[model samples]
Target: MPDNVPMEQAAILADAVSTPFGAVVHTEVRVGESVGVRGAGGVGTHVVQIARLVGATPVIVMDVNDEVLQRSLDLGADHAFRSDDPALQAKVAEKPYLNRT
Candidate 1:
């Protein structure tokens, strides 16, 4: 209900902003933590942005589409991978963030 956002756009905007933020809040994500999001679609993209904004480092995004993976990186994910990759687990484990004792 902001002065700038038209009423017609309000619902969509609210959904776009709230869903990801709510998920982040519910999960209690902390600064410098590694975040791995499984999807890079509409709401998943926003999750990447929100995770980065909250200071999560090495934000990893996984999706089946190469384009989506790239988009996640562009949106501030530290790493992107195809969810269907046979080596997905190994690849994710290789990140330095997850190696910490």
Candidate 2:
């Protein structure tokens, strides 16, 4: 644990960040790569930040909740979409930046 982090917050912080950090590391996300996270809850939110921290570009988030989607954007996601949208796939496909050849 870092000296800057308060002890009271350590466990919660680790629990929140560990899985996402591991997942991002395990996937070997490269700089400038586009990342799409499929949820916007606790773990998903952390994934967005970790991806961004590792230099992933155009980090996109998908979730059913409008508030959660917006929150993802605020947290570091370049784009957010409602998973329940019937046009979600089309919308994502239309984003030219996401379709790197």
Candidate 3:
């Protein structure tokens, strides 16, 4: 852990940081790439930040909660939407790199 970081924060960092960091590294996320996170809870929130940290463009995050979706935007996501939005599929389809599945 870095000396500047608080121990309490550092302790949870491993849990909150590892998965997203590993996924970004292993996926070889390149600059200008697009990233989509399906959930906006603990893990999903970190994924948004990690994707932006790695220079991903149009980081889209989806969740059922409006507040969580907004939080994703506050963090780093370029787009936020409810999972059950009537136009969700259409909106996603319009994005060039967003995988359907």
Candidate 4:
């Protein structure tokens, strides 16, 4: 957040720093590609947003927690599932390209 921005919104700086340096810089995520983030933790959550911003479709996010999985869906993931769920493999298989990292 800028010096003049609200202090409450300072959390935005997390992704503001990670999005460009981590996702966009190190990865070769292309448009129309599918992305599957294995965890919905801090970094993984940001990856979900970055993937969507770059035009990734059917963005998938997998985690052990139901709330986190749902949160990923709310954050732009097309599919969110528990990592241990047997159905996860089948769902991932359905995507044309899944950039799981």
Best by lDDT: 2
lDDT of 3 at 49: 95
Model 1, stretches more than 4 Å misplaced?
Answer: 2-8
**In TM-score terms, which candidate is top?**
1
Model 3's alpha-carbon lDDT is 0.90
Better of 3 and 4 by lDDT: 3
lDDT of each: 0.90, 0.92, 0.90, 0.79
Give the Cα error of residue 36 in candidate 3, in Å. 0.4
Give the per-residue lDDT digits (tens) of candidate 2, residues 1-101: 88998887888677678989998999999999989999879889999999999999989999999999999999899999999999999999999896556
Clashing pairs in 3: none
Which residue runs of candidate 4 sit more than 4 Å off their true CA positions?
Answer: 1-21, 94-101
Show how many residue pairs clash in every candidate, following the order shown: 0, 0, 0, 0
Cα displacement (Å) at residue 55, model 4: 0.7
Residues 1-101 of candidate 1 have per-residue lDDT tens digits of 77998887887667777899998888999999878899988889999999999999879999999999999999999999999999999998877678656
Compared with the true structure, what per-residue lDDT tens digits does model 3 show for residues 9-81?
8876787789888988899999999888999788889999999999999899889999999999999999998
Q: Which ten residues in a row have the lowest lDDT in candidate 1?
A: 92-101
The alpha-carbon lDDT assigned to residue 29 of candidate 4 equals 80
Clashing pairs in 4: none
Which residue pairs collide, candidate 1? none
Off by over 4 Å in 3: 1-11, 95-101
